[model samples]
Target: MNNDTVIVTGSKLTIDEVAQVAINGAKVGIAPEAQQKLTESREFVYELVNSNVPVYGFNTGVGANKDRKVEADYYNQFNVNMVRSHCVAVGPEASQAEVRAMIVIRLNTLLLGYTGMSPAIAYMYRDLLNHNITPVVPERGSIGEADIACLSHIALTMIGEGDAYYHGEKMPAKEALAKAGLEPIMLGPKDGLALVSSNALAAGQGALVLYELKKLIQLADMVYSFSLEAFKGNVSPLNEEINRVRRFRGQNESAAHVRKLLQDSYLWIPHIANALQDPLCFRCACHIHGAVRDSLHYLEELMDIQMNSSDDNPCVLINQNAIMSCGNFEVVNWTVAFEMLGIALSHLSRAACFRTIKLSSEHFTGLPRFLTPDPEHIIAFGTIQKPFTALDAEIRHLANPVSMDFYAVAGDIEDHCSNTPYVVQKTRKIVDNLYYILGIEAIHAAQACDLRQEKEFKLGIAGRVVHQKIREVIPFLAEDRNLTVDIANAYQLLKSGVLLHALNS
Candidate 1:
């Protein structure tokens, strides 16, 4: 575990902080003021419970049973039943880091004072993170109209009725709690609903995806720069003055970064490029990558709101002295943003695939076909195109939006959904696939660079570092025995962030 701690203020939780607590094992603490709000909201909930006022998911029932009234005497049993009934999520389970992300995110929002859950439950969330006790949460079973199906498993662990990972060992939730010197929380009114009726399953996974994408985009720029050097491609398209005219932030950022990566390279030696204009994949890479950046920025902004705001139904209003039914749990806005990101990434996948294809073609690079050092004896990158293109095809298919494809549940009372979890999951798959696609592109680019025996054919700063890094794990296609191993190594190299780190260093 890291020695650092993230203090959740209910209003200022950043995605980076989420990653720290989630992926880096940073401990979490609640701000004093936020804890005060949690206490105040719970008091107000008790006040309503005494007054016999009918509140959705409070005095009354939830969903199709909203009209059903619950006696104050039955609050504990009702809440427990609600939690037990909702544990319907199925495998494959989320990673321990992802479950940690979900817990921290939900814990942060509960501090906003809208969820009238017990303060003890809030502290349980903190304890789980600190003790490294992660609830075994399934990654599926929600149409994203709040992720209740998946999140209920988290509540189940808290109540000591489900499975959990105690310090990385699989065990019963009750046993995990005892091993950590903690006890199971008793469910109270609104506690179950507050715990399960959250988009944390989607949001937590999405945050990790976004963190990876930030690195992936940088990796994309680095690889593209190296490929540009191998192709001896024109650098005019990356000229800042030309890109600045369009005023697109993403395009301009990509163009500027590529220029920086290619600094002090022979590609800039006037008229050194092979052709007047390369294919759109090479010429407009910045534009496509820029579109992804733009989409990512949009999603990040929306995610900020999501991570900080209350997504509770029957949100408690301390100022107004009332509890109101709300659709705050609806995440269509950000869900669609994730959808747009997937589409943008599809473009990125295709561009990388095309660039890899071009690198193997003699018509584009003036090198041996398939980047073979010996045309007769070696078949370097010829059949390798099939796997990368197949991955790209899968990306294209995964990019199709599923947000609008849902049927109403709860007697049609819940008629709409964003399918946010699935959308984020699909985006994760796309990012993973891009690594292989870009990795193959790197392999081809490095081989092409080695084949160019001319002294004038030189590597830029980024190309030199990337070429050296790629060759460390994968050598030149000397005799072309087995390329699958090389492709896997390239994937690991790119996914590991070593090349990006080297370039920056």
Candidate 2:
């Protein structure tokens, strides 16, 4: 496998790779080590099924039927029946990218061989991804106890029993598989349960959200720097000595970023400071944004572990040759982390919204009201505040945690649950709100840059890149024009990674 391929060998699949395949359509391959492990694990499972060892989901039934023994003659039927019975999701289908992500994540986890599945099953997943045979997984019907109904839809497609989107059309899975030059798989003993009874759906969606959020945070830092510069804010708060005593790693890093972003601005003119003290949003820039950065780092580590962990039930320990029941599918940890993420993102978005509002006010940035070029006869960017109000509301609404809202299900056996997928989906919704809010701020900051027209008070390298980039898509609010198009274009620049690249470079 090469860099273009995400090779799964239990320990090598990173969250980054998962996102690559989910979002960028990167290829996937099972490593030789994983193949060998899968073979040995399958041998143990076969032996357990032959002997009277009572392995769950293999020789025995699953959940509420754990004590019931599965006859050897009905192994295939048991697997297929379990999947067919569990496919109860109802609602609009998930996006193709999301379904593809679940396939990739589930494949990576299964390759670890601790789930006691065959290498061919893992290969089936790889083939689906590479062939773009995304199963039509419904969006609802999951209460966060591992993506059961959702993943089962994909399992149905594997057995050639459900609908799928093949090369951009909804068709029968058997026809789609044939079109993709592939064949349907035959489910063995616990194969269906192994495919669907894990947190892959939530984990996959979370992986994609994390990928987008990483860039959003980077862009947020750059926009914060630009807004502070537009305000001619006092740079003293971001000085090296301020963080030297506190010694928070994230804070120190953020303060350093601030310093670098303002190194070329007039605010750094020795004894020249703007207002002695600026607003908390401006003065405590590092503390506010750095806390979010720290939380993001924590989520990254947690996701790294999750992407590689065996998160299925009845985990098979190949070395011990034993299949044991476990509750690894409980994904509350992931939901809690995402909830924290939503809260932190809401704050950052609030910072962006408030900073933009302050920039529009005459007392804050001292520029013309609404950043209008001629405040006499024009209401330039005044109405610009309206959209941000709604954006802020959505961001705040998404920030509320969903982890504490779940209770027992499945006959009280699964008493706890993580609204994992919804949490991640809401986090992505917050990101969607961030695009507009941050874009609006970028527009205002650029307008303020034009109003000040500081020749000698040049913007720092980071701010300069962003200011120049905004100018390319949206000119200064010279006279009032419908800014809807401008806002969209500015957001496109942010979504395209142009600003982040410029700022970091």
Q: Largest TM-score belongs to which candidate?
A: 1
Give every collision pair in model 1.
none
Q: Model 2 over residues 99-138: C-alpha lDDT tens digits?
A: 8888887887887888887667888899988887889998
- Put down candidate 1 lDDT per residue, 1-505, tens digits, no spaces: 9899999989999999999999999999899999999999999999988898888888788999999999888888898899889989989999999999999999999999999889999999999999999999999999998899999999999889889999899999999999999988887788888888999999999999999999999999999999999988999999989999999999999999999999899999999999999999999999999999999999999999999999999899989989999999999999999999999999999999999999999998899898888898887778998999999999999999999999989898889998889999999999999999999999999988988977788899999999999999998788977888998999999999899889888
For candidate 1, what is the lDDT?
0.93
Model 2: which ten-residue window has the lowest total lDDT?
1-10
Clashes of each: 0, 0
Q: How much is 464 displaced in model 2, in angstroms?
A: 1.8
On the 0 to 100 scale, the lDDT of residue 31 in model 1 is: 95
Those runs of model 2 whose alpha carbons end farther than 4 Å from true positions after fitting are 1-3, 503-505
- Please give each candidate's TM-score: 0.99, 0.95
Candidate 2 overall lDDT versus native: 0.83
